[model samples]
Target: MRLKIKRSNEQRLITLPDGATVSDLLNEIGSASINIKVGFPPQTIDISDTSKLLTDSGIKNGEMIIVTDTIETEVPVNKNEVAIATVSNQNDAPYVQIDDIFLVLRKIPDDNSCFFNSVGYCIFGPDSIKYPDSQQELRQAVANVIRENNQGIYNSAILGGKSITEYSQWIQSSNSWGGAIEAQILAEYLDISIWTVDIESLQVYKFNDEMASRFCVIMYSGIHYDAMALKLDTSLDEEDSQICVFDKFSELGTLIEDNVLKLTNHLKNQGYYTNTSTFILQCQICLATLQGEKEANSHAKKTGHTNFGEVN
Candidate 1:
């Protein structure tokens, strides 16, 4: 299998046999002996030291890879060790809590929406802040946390059915206005509640009044499709699951059966490529579902099993 590579801002290509793991492919390209960096925003795995990254991240053949040479510099200390050392050095300094709320807000409102595509965002004050590192594993962990905290903001018009671009804007938007508009938009659009957990003060705030004042909007609009889907599912299910549970595959079914003609017609008529394309694609998905259900029912009848309704 051929693998396209972008390393340290340079274009280089490499080839690997089919079914090769990242480690195996690196070996074939004489890069296994060197430190290899992978990931969109740049993350490194010391292939020369640890091959576990490949196995853990499920990196395998025929996939594009980005590898970078290791940068040598000052001696590094483990985070925990550094924290301990800092605490020891400063007698009166208070220790930082692991779950402390660390908010970094920007003040740029006209930021290009594309910036949010790079990360995941959420509404819960404590659950939203992701780690600083971009390591794939850590990023995934942060994504999971955001997913858990974010309940239903995705399906809302705040996202406008454009997940990638919408999120990019959220990430780039500054919190200079205390993120008031962004937070309010998310709350109104997603129709969910947000509460802040102050670890240091042990105070829980229902509204981020200070947050609003410091930034124009507290934006965590960026998110992956999976996270968005999860939020959408939770939101729809809350409104009488028996009638409105919206699964990805069953999206068209829910839309049509629930009589969402106005919304769907507006989307189709508006020529909003993002929503229109997704809706059209969902039609194909629903057709496949109908076919599958038909086959299942046929088999059930032949086997003398009870028939469950399609909705069930």
Candidate 2:
């Protein structure tokens, strides 16, 4: 039997035996797709239940299945804008919570440089305006850090089968993807602990777990990464400050330890977690929407409109 798996703007056809289960089809899709991340699982809703066997789910041959590789939500986050969520108060500090606890986060552009931009935003805040170029530099920095320690902690296992030079070149590429590996390298480079939260699994992946006054926490919904910040309540203060600084790790740590799991469960219950990926690529010169990557690349090559952003 054949089924059509629709992912983003692309669709793929997969063949399966007549009695294949949903898990079996998922395995096949995992093997055949390159866009899906390794650790993050793929899901489907063809027959209303994700775990039901295809044969038992009333799925017909050549049925079109909407395959979502990442968590889906209609989260309206723009580049340079912050994401704030209201939660129960868990702390008594001045910036902690006066009324409702808010989880503040910054949205990075949905490009290959998201990890770098996210790290940069956490580090320098609005001062980090370098964007794609800064991301390129940070990639080189990560590669350099690995190359300097190639014979020691950084090895082929860490690089995922690439040599030091090969990995260095790969990271420097504009289209190369970044994730926990890059986050770890950036953490060591900046000497700060980086915490990555997976929205689907509700697991916090920490890098450079040592104590630090200032650190970073990013939200990972499988494919893209976004920076997480704390929205402080400044009603008592005479002046309003948009950005809040953490004096101790315990402040944010306590909140995450106490409320992150509950918040995740709440988000799931509210159906805030979704699996939809749609990026609008506009020409920097004329602001026209390009058809796809090929057309965007062709436009850049012909008209030099290299400055493009993903409007989601």
Candidate 3:
């Protein structure tokens, strides 16, 4: 049997034995685990049981199968099960139904302050006016939160080797990117919970979940970040993807969390994933293929081959 390997930019083919199980394929690909999708439009086939045969697993000949060394489980997904991996997000519709409510993204501009803009959109409603300056206020707010902290949590180790003062200045610059640490600070500063979901991995990181009953959702892709909103109307007539913070144990909160999880997992299965570990980068200068971002950066530093693109 032959399988297709899909990465960020390139795809490769590998031949497997008739009895090659999921484990055998993983061993062949040099990955500990993998996410399998086969057939046209691609369906997510459970690769949890490594001993299951490919044919029995519903993989067919010459079919397009996306390969990855990762599996994300939000709910307890059973083994050897199959699920439709199609994306329902359309330009006209642009939202999905989660019970009675609708889920949609309030897109944030990618000016390197996407994180700030996204958080701003979450804090203020979807139609907020804080996006113009890329929300420099949030950056300064994050800087102040870190600067004023007496505890050593925002120390150099967490600052990625920069001193607290230096980090504050750097983050205050218009071009800096805000991430987990800043997220935590803002969660504390605003006294609200924040949940950021990675579409690729479908992992949700919750900040200040305990302190506040209010939380906003944000979606992150390889390129940039966006805010998640929930609204009542099915159509995009209403621009508010209403802020979804609620009592964690309450019925509404549970329902919203479940639906958000459902949406993320569906998107992940639909091949909306970015495998940062195995990004296929090619140097435009020497035509050298690099494995990942680390290798690409090192390649640029060593050979001065900075201009690069996807392998395509």
Q: TM-score, each model? A: 0.26, 0.51, 0.59
Runs off by more than 4 Å, candidate 1: 19-24, 27-34, 37-46, 49-57, 73-150, 155-312
Index of the highest-lDDT prediction: 3
Which residue runs does candidate 3 get wrong by more than 4 Å?
1-94, 244-250, 280-312
Candidate 2's TM-score: 0.51
| Counted clashes in each candidate structure | 26, 3, 3
List of clashing residue pairs for candidate 2: 71-274, 72-274, 72-275
Candidate 1 residue-wise lDDT, 1-312, digit = tens: 556654433445676545455566566556543445444322445454344445455455444455433322222222232111112221121121111110112111222221121121321111112322222322233233334436554433544233543344333332111222333433333333333222223233333332331111122221101111111121222211111112222433223222222222332343312221112111122232223434543543354332222321
lDDT of 3 by residue, 1-312 (tens): 877665322456889887778777778767665556665324679878889987788876665565533422122322223232223343433355554455665566556677877876655444333435326767877888788877767788878667889889888876566789888888877777888899887789999998876677877775467777665555554553354345566555665576676667666665555675687877777999888768876875577445566664
Q: Pick the candidate with the highest TM-score.
A: 3
User: So what's the TM-score on candidate 1?
Assistant: 0.26
- Model 3 steric clash pairs: 215-245, 229-241, 230-241
> Which candidate would rank higher by TM-score, 2 or 3?
3
